[model samples]
Target: MLGNDLPPPTEVINMYKLNQIGLMRIYEPNHEALKALRGSGINVLVGVRNDELQQLASTESAAEDWVAAYIRPYWPQVNFRYIAVGNEVIPGEVARYVLPAMQNLHNAWSSGVLNSIEQIKVSTAVAMSVLGESYPPSAATFSQDTAAYMVPIARYLNSIGAPLLVNVYPYFTYVENPSDVSLPYALFASESAVVIDDGLSYYNLFDAMVDAVYASLEKAGAPQVRVVVSETGWPSGGNGNVTTPSTAQKYNSNLIRHVLSSHGTPRRLGKSVET
Candidate 1:
């Protein structure tokens, strides 16, 4: 779910079976495993390496070439559902590549790599660092440094009908500020009072975090763009101080139930989120 670089095919298959994971994220597209796992009903999200981003962004030819070599050959055989142009290219040195990478992915799709341009979808995953300030639920907003880039990025993603992918973890938030953040609130274990804004009440941290992103998008003038949670989970094991098996189960189980029970965030009530 985190790293795409995996071991050999046999080992990867065994690991997938061992963990009962139906979905996997791979860095480089692999044709052999795609063929081998065809009937296994596994979903894979592939990526274009960072080094290739600049080339892919700047030239339509490069994207077409990359897709033809890395994607088309394995097409129909591999259940390639999503193609992430680049990973976490925001709010850091890599931020410069975000816009170009997005443009390239869009150009690739427009180039008609697939017989039907409507068949394949592309998106880029972003880290929470993209947010300028995300705290106290209502105060969360995109940072100025990221905003200049995010605004255009969000617009391009919207133009291409791609969801904005983000990785959020309330566990990390709570651990970072235990003195201020309540555990039950972070884990969605609390039935306590909710945080209300503009007459909307947030019942959990997950929804609040999502709404924060939604708000940021609205502020960026891309309110129609959908937000997808590319990653969110609790680790079962970590340094004794931060994590343990018991807490991990409690956190992840409850989070799963919370997501399953909801169709969309308060900001986009009743609307279906790509997730």
Candidate 2:
């Protein structure tokens, strides 16, 4: 959720505790949000913007300085687990700077300044646009044009044991091709029959999309790199079978149940997922 949508930072943390939300992702390291989250016990994944990539990528010193300024001040208290180097950056804009920026940030985290601190995982968020094909949960492949940028990024994430973060929105798919993608499948409801592809049955569009990303990672020769859904939600108000409040409720409720079940996707069963 965007910081603006929430109440004051301290109240936000209180609300999260009240709701039992174990983890939250903040797009930027807003001082108030970080400060409020301090000692709240809720985990956070703070982000670095594409605009800041150039600055952080310029020098190792700059990356270290960023860590010093934004991260260290709210250390063990905030429970910040990951440093998202960039958000939805691939195939359209800021593609070139993604990997280099990640490397510099990771290097900075590993430097002596933060050596005692648990090394925060460094990664970038990618959109489904990076995939050339994402159907059947088996034929997904990285776009050829993005290979130069994606291959190295995948390899680096694999080596560091960091998951590949990708935003998957079934809402967009249904909105774009409502005639083909049914509302039930998109909403994680049982109104529709399961769609079988490559001998695997897909009861929900979310699993299919996630598995498609796994297949793409395999095609990129980064099969060891785990795929994590960085963002996914259905809008409460919009025209269409999938975008209504009822459908959104069903989708979100079922999504929560599916996640808490800890039963991974059909393609990678038994593997736990991080939202």
**Per-residue CA lDDT of candidate 2, range 1-275, in tens?**
45456567788788889999998888988898888888899878889977898888888888888888898899878887778888887875677888888888888777676776655788889888888888877998888877788888998998888888888888888788778888778877755447788888888888888998899888778889887777888898857544678777887888888877768898888886678
lDDT of 1 by residue, 29-143 (tens): 6666665666566667787787777777777778777877876676666666678767877766766776776676667656544755445568778877778776544566789
Supply the global lDDT for candidate 2: 0.83
Off by over 4 Å in 2: 1-6, 191-193
Alpha carbon deviation, residue 150, candidate 2 (Å) = 1.3
| For every candidate, C-alpha RMSD to the true structure in Å | 3.1, 1.9
On a 0 to 100 scale, what is the lDDT of residue 103 in model 2? 89
Q: What's the TM-score of each model vs. the native?
A: 0.85, 0.94
Q: Tell how far residue 50 is off in model 1, in angstroms.
A: 1.7
